[model samples]
Target: MILEVATITLRSGNADEYVRVMPDAFPVLASTPGYIRHELHRGIERPDVFTLFVWWESVEAHNVNFRESDRFPRWRAVWGHLMEGAYVEHFAQVY
Candidate 1:
């Protein structure tokens, strides 16, 4: 399996709005092929920071299957504007 980790920073005072609108993007994400599950976590020390964890069957499931699909834009439209910046990376269990 592949694990996608996205560290996202929101614009000032946008954290509440971002969390409120997150559910609107779930359907779009869940419908994607190879999508397993996901989680969103807020940083305690930095209220404006969030971390998104997504599990997929493989890297291609996200990079190609999802990102290349029409759902990408739809998903982004949900909260993209709320983000000041984001960094994404994929990982696999070493053991």
Candidate 2:
């Protein structure tokens, strides 16, 4: 399994806009092949910080396929303005 977490700090006063604008992109990614689940998490200690957790069958399933798709550019464009400091990482774990 592959889990990707994207942590973003929205520009001041743009949190609402960021949340409101994500639905347009989220559904597409959620429906992609190999997609398992996705969740938007709000930081407990930081209000402006948000994390997107995306689970996929494999890294290639999410990274290679999703990143190269046309929909990704659209998603990026939609959220570009609201993003201030963003960091994304992938992790693996054994259950």
Candidate 3:
């Protein structure tokens, strides 16, 4: 399985609103091929920091199949206003 994590740092005071927006946008991503799961996590110690975990069966499944699809545009619009910046990482489960 391939895991993609996007660490999002909201522009202060917007974190709670940011978290609330995700589930509503999920249907756009969930319908894509090879999308195994989607999860969002917030930092307890750091606060206002979030990690969006996306489980895909393969990189190509995301890069090739999903990105070019129609859903990403609507997905982008969902939280486009609340974001500051994000860092993304692709990882494989080693444990």
Candidate 4:
């Protein structure tokens, strides 16, 4: 399995809007091939900071199946404007 971690920082006063709009993309993401699951976390001390943990069958599954598909743009269109900065990376279980 592959894990995609995305660290996101929201623009000032955009936290509430971000949270509201975030779940809107779940259906799109869930429909993606090879998309296993995902979790969204917010920093306690810094509410504007969030990290999205996504599980996929593989990196290609994430990229080709989701990011390369219409879902990617659908997702970005909803939240891109709210982001102050964001970064994404992939990971694997150590075992």
Clash list (residue pairs), candidate 3: none
Backbone clashes in model 4, listed as residue pairs = none
TM-scores vs. true structure, each candidate: 0.97, 0.88, 0.89, 0.95
For 32-66, candidate 3 gives per-residue lDDT tens digits of 99999989889998678888999999988787777
Models ranked on TM-score: 1, 4, 3, 2
| lDDT per residue as tens, model 1, 1-95 | 98999999999999999999999999999999999999999999999999999999999999998999999999999999999999999999898
Candidate 4 residue-wise lDDT, 29-94, digit = tens:
889999999999988999999999999999999999999999999988988999999999999999
Candidates 1 and 3 compared: the better one by TM-score is: 1
Q: After superposition, how far is residue 32 of candidate 1 from its true place, in Å?
A: 0.4
The C-alpha stretches of model 2 lying farther than 4 A from their native spots are none
What is the Cα-based lDDT of residue 54 in candidate 2? 93
User: What shift in Å separates residue 22 of candidate 3 from its native position after superposition?
Assistant: 1.4
Q: By the TM-score metric, which is better: model 1 or model 4? A: 1
Better of 3 and 4 by lDDT: 4
Model number with the top TM-score = 1
